[model samples]
Target: MFAENKLTDDMAEIEAFLVRERAKVLSEAEWKFRMRGYGYNLRRTNGGVEVARLPQNTVLGTLAL
Candidate 1:
């Protein structure tokens, strides 16, 4: 028991968003570079490597090196 028209409109909006922003999507490296300016760093984890945001003071001090 559901409204079919409501579901159709929701799906249409999602499709439209994907189509419009398809070209604006960033590559993995691009994303890393962009976020790096905000104090994020890549680190090794038990499972795999991941990017994390460090404390502002610590990041700034490291960058001064």
Candidate 2:
């Protein structure tokens, strides 16, 4: 299938794109959190678990996992 044709290089490219997208999500979450208060942040680690003071931002972060 299409998956087989995707070389390791192609796979790496995809992963990079995904990571960039995930960073975007995290930035958005951070913005939302900062809007409400200080000393709060929305962040997602490589493990895919999102720890955010805003709470609901964690739901979208599962995709990064």
Candidate 3:
């Protein structure tokens, strides 16, 4: 649905969309901290930083497929 050209990659676009979704879900402080790490940090907390992986084909909500 977001193809800009005939050869555009849909999975790349979908990944970008998911990144945007994750950004939107984070708080302002969390966003700033995350941006400071060059988008490397996945789990940010008072305990410690931990990298996390999301499952494939995972639905976020009723609005998400």
Candidate 4:
């Protein structure tokens, strides 16, 4: 049916959007890890992937104290 097809198309579009957003997050994480000595981790959850930044030992890190 037309409604079913429309639903499928909508699902595909949503999936594509999530993929793009995930890619962007990964790219930014990679850049930060490489250029700024930042640490990161990607974990899978019931909802979706979670991008987390690990603590880094930096001058600025201590300044926050």
Q: Tens digits of per-residue lDDT for model 2 on 1-65?
A: 01123433243443454455446555666543432352223355677544332323322223255
TM-score of each: 0.32, 0.27, 0.27, 0.27
lDDT of each residue in 1-65, candidate 4, tens digit only: 01222432243443443344446555745533442332324344565444343453211111000
Clashes of each: 0, 0, 0, 0
For candidate 3, give the lDDT: 0.39
Every model's Cα RMSD, please?
14.9, 11.8, 11.9, 15.9
TM-score computed on alpha carbons, candidate 4: 0.27
- The segments of candidate 1 whose C-alpha lies over 4 angstroms from its true place after superposition are 1-24, 43-49, 54-65
Tens digits of lDDT, candidate 1, 1-65: 01122322243442343233334546645544544553445343564434343443222111100
> Of the candidates numbered 1 and 2, which has the greater lDDT value?
2
Please report, in order, the local distance difference test score of every candidate based on alpha carbons.
0.36, 0.39, 0.39, 0.35
lDDT of 2 at 53: 29
Q: Which one wins by TM-score: 1 or 2?
A: 1
- Arranged by lDDT with the best first, the candidates are 2, 3, 1, 4
> After superposing candidate 4, which stretches have Cα over 4 Å from the reference?
1-9, 27-65
Clash pairs detected, candidate 3: none
* CA error at residue 6 for candidate 2, angstroms: 13
* Count of clashing pairs, candidate 1: 0
Q: Kindly give the stretch of ten consecutive residues in candidate 4 with the minimal lDDT sum.
A: 56-65
